[model samples]
Target: NLQLLTELDFAMAKGKLSLDMKAAAPALNSEGRIVLHQARHPLIKKEDVVPIDFELGINYHSLVITGPNTGGKTVTLKTCGLLTLMAMAGLHIPARSPSEVAFFDLVLADIGDEQSIEQSLSTFSSHMKEIIAITELAGPGSLVLLDELGAGTDPSEGAALAIAILNFLNQTGAYTVATTHYSELKGYAMNTEGVENASCEFDIESLQPTYKLLIGVPGVSHAFSIAQKLGLSQDIIADARQLISEESARFEQLITAIESSQKEIDDKKSEADKLQRELQEMRRTLEQEKEKIAKEKQELLAGAEAQAAEIVNKTRRQMEEIIESLEEKRAEQRLGHRLESELRGQISEVEKELSAHRHKRSTDQQPGEIEIGERYEAIDLNIEGVAKSLPDAKGQLVLEAGQISFSVAADRLRPVGKKPKAAGRRPRAGQAAGRTAASLTTERKMHATTELMLRGMRADEAIAAIDHFLDDAVLNGISPVRLIHGKGTGVLRQVTQDYLMRDSRVDSFRMGVEGEGGDGVTVAKLKL
Candidate 1:
């Protein structure tokens, strides 16, 4: 119970810390590298601390930081060590996301002067003692932090010792971060492989450290510049600079020039990033506008269709009323065949107009080549027929359905055949024979029987015969035809009635009564 309560309390504390300090949990890996991005020391005040970017163990196993004194070099080293330890403890560190820490079996440090007067040890001796102990324990699974490495001794001897110590530790395969102001160490890092140079920036104008760590560049001590800024006499500063070697002065000037160029490049890159973000936002806005326009267009089209349908229905009703009135007058012997023929012509014209309207609204089907002699279905007319000719220059083709021919647009036809001969190709011998049979069948249809006989025939054969008979009756203007199926089990009669119900040419159908063959025959009325 105590352990559970402790874990709950720790979770709450971590959440609160993350909100207050802008801390993030680091990714842990076994890749033998530590990457700290914009990391701050946990003990430092959030507003005062300058975040530093530090990396080790990938490109270089050891880093030698060089800069002016009091320029946050030690702070950078401490932040890396502290964040690494915090990550190993499963605690969030004060850094941005994508910060990664490699696990280490040991964390060692030789920071600050540990002079012991009682033991008769000087500052340099004290530092060496601690460094010796670190060397003995550090290995590939260790993180070593050495601040002011090889300090508290003569400049030349200390630099040489620092270079030797760094080389030895690197050979041991341990990840190390050390700080120094020696120019020789900087040159060593530059010329050696698996060793990189880093610096904590110092602003001479402000006489303060920016504390921003820059990798892949060595730092300038800025001693003469800082002294001049701090009111030191020009003559004294000049004499101090004269004591330095000519090569060292030129090297420092080169470092200053490189730093200036790097700053300019960083500024341009930031501007480019801002422009990229703006372009992305504009693209998203344009996509939303396109979707909105499409939806509005669909709504307007639906409203227009509903209005068109209402107008067509009203016209059909008016035409029916006029036809009924004329029929009534004819029954009284007041009108002749002339008036009936004129009414039929008017009805055909209306049907043609209606079919054109439906074809215009059907925009989904794509236009395709109209192959000659191939069976196709007319989408608007709901009829299947053979294509008699290839599409003309205007994409119009002649289609024959039931004894009637129509010149329709290629877009109004959908092919229904498995294989169709190409346009402008001559028919093979077999296809020519098939065409001869079709012509003979058409001739037979001209003398079609007014009364159809379906007795003793299968259901499928009866339906096929009924379809062909109805087509002939419509073409010959025959009405009130008798379909004699001879009711027995009633299957043929039921099938006959069902087929007639779905045929558009069949205006009406009914079973005969009494003298008209009773229930044994079905009388059909076809549209003239």
Candidate 2:
């Protein structure tokens, strides 16, 4: 347990260091490929290290890297091999996320000098011994790193031997990365399948390495250019350039042109990536704004509905007070038949308005038009009745339910089965059937005068008298009824019109026109 704790402490310390270095956990790829994104060597200072992007073992099994010396080609080779070993050993690699490392049974490398003076083996001979061992041991599960393959020998023979060795490794299915300065090797990679060329960039003006790895572009040695920049005579440089064949010079020129084009392509790709990110951000912002607007719209609607409800409730309470006052007058036997009829109409209208505000009717089934003399059901009151009159301008119609006639809104009633047939016999001309004393009294009330005199009455008394008169006028279908309230101080006329305005049965009221009693009277139009 103590040993296990010690190992835990060591792991925690390593994790902290990884966080400080911004290292990412490496992903294992099963397709025999390694992809390193912005990978830097851990031993190198972070600011000084030039991160490299490298990939292999998928499109190509072998990579032949060519570049000028001290241009980071060797460092790239070492970085790939070391990172692979680190990932396989379960250590976080100094690379960005999405870095994938392939699992290899053996990580083989033949980098740097291998000369052995004690064994009497020259540089070329020593490298041959190492190459022979690699050829024997490397297989499909090996990650081989061969730096400066076929150096310290004749250029033509060495280039041929390098190509042959690379072909053998490809046959073995080993993932190989090698560095060389031979132009023949670059040509071989271009023509051969499953082989790719890569290079490190160098700045000729500064005589410094940029250390930027560019895949699919062969490297240039810059031998003549470097010598001239270092103060070598122009004649000597020209003489040296002439030693090379025209084919070789043209091949080098082609590589230089390709490098420039690759740089431009990389710049365009970066710009495209930046634009894509900005568009994505804009889309997200627009979506959020849309959601906010929808939410605010719903809130506004809810507030308006609440305000309307409060107004309805307030109006309901006022109407209830008016009904209570009429009821009190009726219980005291102070209301005549006309006033009693007005009270019932007022109660019916108020109840219907209140019921509509209280409940929302379903829209699934619609109520058909209510025709006169048709049997229908009052949905709110839950009572069946027969329509006695067609709807008025306000959609209110008279309904006779259980021998009691009352006004109801047309929307509250639904037709019941078929309309009833007219069965009652018509009275003879100038005569009526079952005429009685009560009927005669009703006829006299219906024929009441279209004018009411409130000239000498108080405001309260005139209000009550005008209410009764309007009710009778509406029952008798008399519109533009006149009220003689007089122009004395304008108090009576003001009160009269005010009462008319409040009464639902009164459509409108105004001071009488010329020859119609002028300002001394009020003319009210009742809702028939």
Candidate 3:
């Protein structure tokens, strides 16, 4: 499952990454790294895409783009190389073209001059080594980029070495782009069929490079313009221009024309400024309105929520009041039921004792109070009776007990304040004398037994109770009975079990595992 989720996440990220890359149009081999009207600085924060056009290799192995210093010569090199790398890495490139590349195995770039002090290699030596590495590794399928090539060393030695490296790479059929200030390399591009030359634009009147790229024209350094910008005297600039040959001077004149055109372009830029300002104002107005609406909506929601909370609070209070009233009524009802049960029990006991007393009075009375054909109670409280009539219709005393006419079941009647008449009749054969007092005492003794009372138990307490019950069962013969403590928090089970351990009376006991009573019941086995 973890592997499956990881794959799904990777697939999602890949698709998203692909979409972002596709959205950034880049110039590649299929569309030609030659961007027509490309507008982006090679190393500028927030690069603006400049509308300039150029081509690399429609039929050329190398395009040597050059222009005046501080123009876009190095920038052009970086833009092309960086975009190519970006594309190959499956990242979006800032370009406007149908850019694509057959996955190149290597993209070798030697752009800026970065000294390697740690490696103890000079600037020129480092560059030469990097160049050597690129040439050895580059093949027909590889892309190679070089910037300001052969500029770190002496011009004569550097130019010769640069030419040799270019020739070696060109022989390998490796695609390469190199930037150089050496006029010798421009001549090499002109002579070599596969090599091309391009230049970044420069202005003449104000003496500034347009920082724009142009193809089909190699460029020269604007030495005089830069010298003047750096506060050099006019005499020095004139002397420098005179030192150059007539052909170089004429090339300088042509560069002046391009510079004049750049002024005209700058003048025409006002319209773009006006459009940008208008867009900014509209965006500000929209944002202000959005903020106002958002704040109002938030306040309204807060108010509604407050009202809702108030209502809930009020309802809660009312519910509490109703619950309190119900509890009070339930308590009163429970108390009333208890009082009524207690009263009933007291009345029943009193009536039983009164019945027993009246029966004893009648049995112990003299003969005058219990004459023949008179009514009387029985001696035994369990037997309540009254005398009806004598047997043989002779008006003799006939005793009536509960559910039985008990001349037999009832006690004999006695008169008040007189000796009992005992010689009235003799006993029949096989009839024993009346029950003895000692025998009655023995019967009462036989009926006596033990009872149990328990309350408020935890689980261990319950187990102990069971153990004690086992003891009681063996001692008192109490069986097939019930425990009367009401169901409550099941602490009883824990306490009961704790107490049951090592208890001498317990044989075996367990929480009834199933219908035997679940957590609520325990069953015990006793040695008895």
Candidate 4:
């Protein structure tokens, strides 16, 4: 049954495996450059994918891998050697595209256990035979894999012999991968000019082998995360980490910091994009207002001109009737008679009355003139310190901006100074600043932080936006304002507290208790 299970596992692994040998394959070149583009291990399950790709430096020659048991040290060696062998054999490797390889005369592998049952040869003797075969068959183009090289011997002897064998392979200029539990071999990788160390990634969260390979870094045992995952106490994990080299700890910290910084940058970019959209919306609203005001002004001016024309026509008709009546009366009367005198006196009186009416009408028709007490249309004159007042006789007129108490006559007003040539034209005047009545009714039209909080973002995100808001709020100089975050998961509230804790400008912040909106709001006090 055990044999059957093993065979089934091997078949399944083989069936799931695939390889690519096209242009898209990782950077493997003749210059001893190792590139495994999107290369995944065939033996690893799809669910537990071990994806890794790396180029052996253009100067790469050999590598020695060292890590905890089953940490993928041996697996990495096999993957590298097997892929190379497969490529040489004209077989595709599980890479994204074509793999590059140079022709080699011999391929050798010595992985897994080999115990001689006949007792005719000892372990060391058997190992020597394999080594002799390699030294004899190896050429400049040979590729070799050695598992636990010089292991199962005295520690001092094993390390010395391993180093010697590595040196020999380096001189032979053959590609090689060797794995060992000995720490001394790692030095061989580090000190040798063309040799490097590679490792499989392990997760700090799950304490499971991510099986992801990272080149240029020696593998770590990850005894702490593993131990912790296995139900060890915190004290044990802490002690284990303490025993690790400070450099390794620092390296892990650097990786986490890099990931965190990337996320933060992405968040900030999103925020900036949102702000840009808001600004665009505000501009659109302003433009619409200007258009509406212009239409209103057109309608108003048309009505005024029509009224003025009608009045002038009516006055002319009335004057003509009076003159005709007087002429008729005079014609009927005898020459130099009493009736003629009476008719002349009546005509003279009518002429005086007409003249008075004309003078009154002219004086009353004051265009663009602003009367101090009367109501006037608020015109955004687009000039600093000036606004267009009621029209008096001459043309449009401006009153000083912010002095609603007084009005300037239209004849006294002048055109505002022009902006620089490079400046774009302001929205056409005569349109009321086009804000919808609904928009102006309330100031709380989704404060910048509100949207993020509603999206269930992290506390840190809310805090950052609030920090930005506080800076702007300081500019606005709003005092004793309520922060309406709404009743959320309490994340916003906690984040608000954290922000207030750090902000020197905030004097105090209190969550609305019971009747004051409970957790829905926070009232903040700022120092100026």
Candidate 5:
């Protein structure tokens, strides 16, 4: 039961982390291939983080990512390894849809600083030792990540060693990704089949890392460019560039040109996408307007046809009335029936003239008198409101819905049901929303705590109290928690500050200023 509960907790935590990181489940693969789309590191901050797309084991079983320092090479390597491990362990990973991972029998990594003081080994020695063990143990259906594969040793020897190591890993049929600054390794990746080159892009104009990964492109060092920007003399830069071998200089120049061209193409592509979206939006708006106008025109035409029919019926009724009166007068005067028949014929001609008269349909209301506080509905607007004022000179009625009042054409609105009594006022907004006392209580309890007071308590007691307080604050995801520890000798404040420094959950803390209880109080930001 305990083990089952532990597994349940782990699954829930994984779900929460995936949700917060915008991660999704990866498609597990039987083939030794892994692909990630818009993958980002969950540990890194949201704003500072960048998403990258990469694939392995498709055309190549190994990948080589080369770029300048702090250009996200190491982070990218770790993210790929960690996400694979997470997926293998039945946890979701931070990546976009269509992401996939291969189930590896074993995963090995030698990332970050691997210097060992107890073993008296240099960085290069440690890396070589680890890779040697990895080579023996790693077999088909395995994954490996090596950082600066040949670093901290002689340049030529290290590059030579890295090439041999990668070659062996390839023969073993295992997927590998390694970061390096060596130009030789970049060339090796370019020439070697199933070993593609990838780079973290940098913006030359901003002199900043874009952290975007570009596959099948070699990266440039940009050492001279950075030096020139840092006030290095032009003559010195020129001399440095001249001393380099022609082949090496040409290779670097080629990489730089590729980066520039890629950046330009990406910029143009982005601009074209924006213009396409704007054009699509305009087209949609135009279509909607066209439909609305067509419907309105059809409705007006139908109303005109109905009014013309009504005019013809009204003329026929008037003609019949005149004929009856003429018949009564003929009987009273003892005139002949022929005269009456002639009068009826005359009336028919008059009726025909009246029927032919052009009917002028009036959309105007006939002197409608609106009353205040009367409930009304606008057929065209599809809304119900209460009349706030009588019609104005333009025959427009003022209606109020909540606090908003607007003038609408009087003919558009008509009374709905009976008038609502002014004595029975509408309920408050919250009450109308069905909020109860219990709901209000729950809201108060859920409100996060913003302050904690710990005066006159011993250092240990205060520490425990503040620790619990901080845990609650983190669970509630609140920041700038104020700790009031009263100033006498400032022992409590000192202890509190010490505790905060060792606590990794606290992002930062500072003593309060003059208006904010001065040195007696401490404000700490929590990392939730």
Candidate 6:
């Protein structure tokens, strides 16, 4: 009963912790592996702390973390240790879903400043004491975290000692994570198998740590930058650089180049993703337009078919009614074959008129050129006539078809016979297809101005000038003339708006938007 109650309480507490930390329950494995993604420290302020990604124990059994002091290395170490413990205790860890952890039979940690005067132990002594114990007890199914390993000691001896200690723990089959400022240890992780390096990213310009952990890369201290930012002399910085070996300097340069290239690649990838999204959206819009246009076309075709069928049915009924009436009169006239033949001719003529309405002017009747003296047939009216005056401004021609005078658009007229020969002279070959003299005159009359700019004129002068412009625009069949009035004291705008409101020629008027010269331009639409 006690065990059951304890288990229930544990589950409830884990659920609450998961909600509070915005964490997911991590995967447990017997083969000893750990992978955490976007994992935050449980104790750190959530708003301020940046979550880190960490992986170990599969191909690489250990990882070395290197960066400047106080750059969240210690926090990262603590977070990894605590989360592992939490997972082993059946508590949900502060990490993303599908985060995996190794079920360790024993967990050991040697983190933080452990200097103690009462115990008569220095920081180095405390670290060594913990390291010895970890090396002895740690084996397969064990986890260990050591912060600033071999710190508070001599530089050369400490780095060498830290490497040896890490190697021993790794051989024991215990997954180890350690933080340090040792450049030698970085080299060790690079050349050694089953070991990896990670760096907490730092901004060069801001001289601040970005707190982003990048695995599979060694970290540099940037001691010169730190010293220079703290007001150290350039000569001192130069001397410090002189102390670094050529190999180490070259390695740092290579790392810098790699990072620069990586950043450029990332930027290009982001831009490509954006362009792909825009292209997909455009494709979707085009498909929708195609569907809409197809639907409208089908509707238009259906309407045309229905209309044609109605016209044919009405024509057939009219022919039947005429036939019936003619048959009724057959007895009075004693009609026979002649009357039937006349009736057939009359119905054929009516059918021809109705059928020809659907056809355009035939190719043979359409002449390349026609003048006042030129004779042509009207395909619609079915009459041959001489072209009188050339087309008016609207392309309508006055025709005299056997003294049946009428006016028709040029499109309705078509030439019938060949060009007549001049008296005692031959005509030029090209002149037959050339346009007439009257065509030029009519084209000139059709041309008119569509825009009028009135910037410097007075309100009355501008209004007066626009009155003539609008008259010409209406005559030439041009609507929506723009009037450019300078944005002065709203006087000119008021004058134009008032004039437009009263003018019967103007169908409507509106002010322009920014690109169209807002508040300074008025667009007036003329009546049809």
lDDT of each: 0.83, 0.84, 0.62, 0.61, 0.81, 0.79
Task: Give the per-residue lDDT digits (tens) of candidate 6, residues 385-502.
Answer: 8888888889888888664677877876767664344788765643321222223322333446777788888765776677667766774678878888868888888877887897
Poorly placed runs, candidate 3 (over 4 Å): 1-22, 25-54, 100-102, 204-209, 254-528
The local distance difference test score of model 4 is 0.61
Q: Residue-wise lDDT of candidate 3 within 1-528, one digit each (tens)? A: 999999889768756754643335554454234443344443454444454454554688677876666687777777776666656766555554654443456778997777788988888978888887897798776778888788788998899888888888888877788888887887788789888877777665577667766555667777777788889999988898889899867765775565456446645665676788899999999999999999999999999999999999999999999999977965675465457545545544554554455456565443344445444544442333456764444424566654556443323444222323458776543122122322332233334233223456543344445544544355445443333333366555554554445545456666655654466555555455
User: How many clashes in candidate 3?
Assistant: 29
Question: What's the lDDT for candidate 1?
Answer: 0.83
Candidate 4, residues 139-255: lDDT per residue as tens digits? 676777888788777978988998888889878887777877666676578788888876555556766565555555666565665677789999878887789699868755654
TM-score of each: 0.57, 0.55, 0.44, 0.40, 0.52, 0.50
The numbered model that scores best in lDDT is: 2
**Which RMSD values do the candidates have, in order?**
25.9, 19.1, 19.6, 35.9, 44.7, 28.3
Per-residue lDDT of model 5, residues 239-343, tens digit only: 999999999998899998888888788679779978998999999999999999999999999899889889988998898899889658634533443364355
Ranking by lDDT: 2, 1, 5, 6, 3, 4
Model 2: how far is 229 from its true place, Å? 2.3
The sequence of per-residue lDDT tens digits that candidate 2 reaches over residues 257-371 is: 8987887796797699789979999999999999999999999999999999999999999999999997787545444545677555765465455446423642344557767
Question: Of models 2 and 6, which has the larger TM-score?
Answer: 2
lDDT of 2: 0.84
| Candidate 3: residue 117 Cα off by (Å) | 3.1
In terms of TM-score, which candidate is stronger, 3 or 4? 3
